[model samples]
Target: MNCDLNIYCDESTHLPNDNQPFMVLGAIVCPVNKTSEANSRLRELRIKHGLPAYFEIKWNKISPAKVDFYLDVVDYFFDDDDLEFRTVVAGKEFLDHDHFDQTHDDWYYKMMFLLIRNVVPSPGQAFIYLDKKDTRGGEKVRKLHEVIANSIYDFDRRSIRRLQIVESHHVALLQLSDLLLGGVNYANRGLNSSSAKRRVLNRMQERAGITLTKSTLLSETKFNIFCWQPRGNRP
Candidate 1:
């Protein structure tokens, strides 16, 4: 009965007409077993880096400066081995003002899928946490969760043991990570008439050599479109 715990956090921005790129950022963290040498190493590394006491390293307060210190600690301990932590930042550009009529669900799903694929967790027990997109008991948030769940379930049944989605405003760690990785995305946005949306599309094509089709663009817009679905009995 080995308990392996993993957590995932993501952030998304949906703005129309604004040149600012819509971005999603995600991060994964795994806690090594307490008895293992990894735990001891983590503690030692924290001490070496002169970071705040272990208990004080909460997620909400982690800024770029803190991340720098933490990564220094991580490098000290796990530099030799291939550590599993990862951060993903995805950006989508908006060209047409009319495109807002479409939805962003597909892009969200695709980004999550990409993140999951990179993490490649084992079949052991795992817990997933998502920053809540909807508050005030909104129906749209409920429907988005269902779509996300169905997509993941379709990809791998029983891939995760439990999933918890809560408001990002309440989760300090998710908020910190989102701010850090999302900053990079914002910096990459196009200037003036140029936009991150266009750059994202171009980068995708150049890296993957997959040209964006009119249908794909329309579909992505459709996915981004707003919709409210009630979270009745679906889990």
Candidate 2:
């Protein structure tokens, strides 16, 4: 089975006790054949902005000095039709894990499923790469693979070919995922600490034609957002 698509995923402020009220999980979906070209353009963008080729595009690293470059990167993503993004944002302040009979990790896996469930096309195949978070992340990766594969009934694992953890710096697309996910996280958190970050987020909002804080139509292919609302009574 040929995996025609590649999905690079990243998460921001997802820790259960990170003191952050919101968490964002996101993925960059790109055609396998266009991956090389996409990376090439990103590299070019970096060089064009006087950044080293090896410099990673990280949202946290954005500053007034580099705002223009980051804004261009945002535009590049939207200009390229082959690139698409989808994210799941959750407000974690009121989660009742005990009442739900599940751990935070379990809910995390469910969020992962929500992020990609609708992005996978019918009769299409994809390989998922997640940014490595910690030492135990390998185990989480395996479990997430199981959750997704089972959800789609891909018992043979053909439709969802593989799921693995990768270092963000090693994968250009993963870094891009981090930037895009960061914007959603920042917007949802209602932060204004960084003018540079706000500038970048404004560019993204303008290009996508939607406020990042709210959920976009699921059918919105270019920049899809799902604001997950937790249900059920608390214990």
Candidate 3:
């Protein structure tokens, strides 16, 4: 069997009119055989924190009371050798849907490609999990799956086996994506309302040895950041 990669994806401030400075798409990648171990480790984190077995890990739920628990989760991600994350941040300041002759939806799919560039191994199949973001229909999601598969030149769509919408609460790795992506979005936008959130950001800086305020090096493997800006304008 081809050893596949499982990618748990989540996004922050994705709405076209949300008025946020950046739209962040982040993913957690793990080898096929290691998925269960990753899930178990995250579940253990919840138990370590006294959270209920059913507790749903989330970025927006971080607070003073739960800050330490969240920090430990962050640390686990950094310490785990089998896990990896990458993010692409697109600024909305000078974006024009009309200029690209694309609907906001179309632009989103394109950005998704950039977010995973070089992250997917072509020789191995990839399974992508996205948080349930819309109920309009499944057709959009289906189209996105096709687009990605095609971009990878997987015309038969075999290399990329699946791209499905899932509830974040049930998926530990997806929730991790939410937390890490939230910290990136918060730090980039200069929002520091929570000390715990700031702590995660600072910790990431200390580990990555790069400021989170800008794009990371193209070759950064553990936590890669890609900043997307308008061609003629400063981001």
Candidate 4:
């Protein structure tokens, strides 16, 4: 484990009964040394847009008023060579947890593993950070660390170094993850309510060169996505 990487993870519409049709798990992968640079550049972009340096970028906040700023953010992400995004989009309608004898949380952790497995490099170390969602944040972190470490056979916890919860508002990379994840979830749900959101999604599709509703090749590294299906579900 010579090189180091940082993974900022986030999710959208993951609740069991949130009336949403899809759940999205997303992450931003950056080399440990490039984290600071990326954060600084994002802040600079905020200032360039006449917003405060501490302004938190979020998907829900996207509107016609600030569409250009958000568009610039999308362009910055695709232009940067040091940053990469990956997500797992799963339809909740296809879920049958009882048939598999697994709780929703168990399935979520399993998806977390699948989401990061392709990005975790061999002969390197990774530190994971998930957005703070609720009071069970600590428990989720512990379970996620255990599952990821065990799946990688990192009993000694050397390769998978640290897993913790962080506030998305305070972490630029985590905020970026939320924005990208929200866009993917919005696309998969086949909704076109907001023109601003539609523009953002269109920009992502143009840059990634794949329909947001479909899965990309496993080897695609820059803007990778996996559309997960249940055991008996058809594509």
TM-score, structure 3 vs. true? 0.94
lDDT of 3 by residue, 1-235 (tens): 2358898888999898898988999988889899899888888888888998667778788888888888888889999988889998888778888876888888888888888656777678888888898894387678788788888788897887878899888888888899889888888888878786777778777876778668878878789889998666444
Single out the weakest 10-residue window by summed lDDT for candidate 2: 226-235
Model 4 TM-score is: 0.97
Deviation in Å, model 4, residue 151 alpha carbon: 0.7
Residue clash pairs of candidate 3: none
lDDT of candidate 2 vs native? 0.90
TM-score of each: 0.48, 0.96, 0.94, 0.97
Better of 2 and 3 by lDDT: 2
lDDT of 1 by residue, 1-235 (tens): 2345555566545433445554545553544342244445555655765763353333234454555554443243234232233343444542322344434555555556555443435545555677665553345444444555565563453555556676655543444345433433443443223243334334433432333221122123101111212223224
Determine the C-alpha RMSD for candidate 2 after optimal superposition of all C-alphas: 1.8
Question: Per-residue CA lDDT of candidate 2, range 1-235, in tens?
Answer: 1238899999988999999988899999999899999999999999999999868999999999999999999999999999999999988878988988999999999999999887665687888999988898779988998899999888888888878888999899999999999999998888999999999999999999988999988779889999986786433
Question: Which regions of candidate 2 deviate over 4 angstroms?
Answer: 1-3, 233-235
Q: Write down the lDDT that model 4 would get.
A: 0.91
What's the alpha carbon RMSD for model 4? 1.6
Over 4 Å off, model 3: 233-235
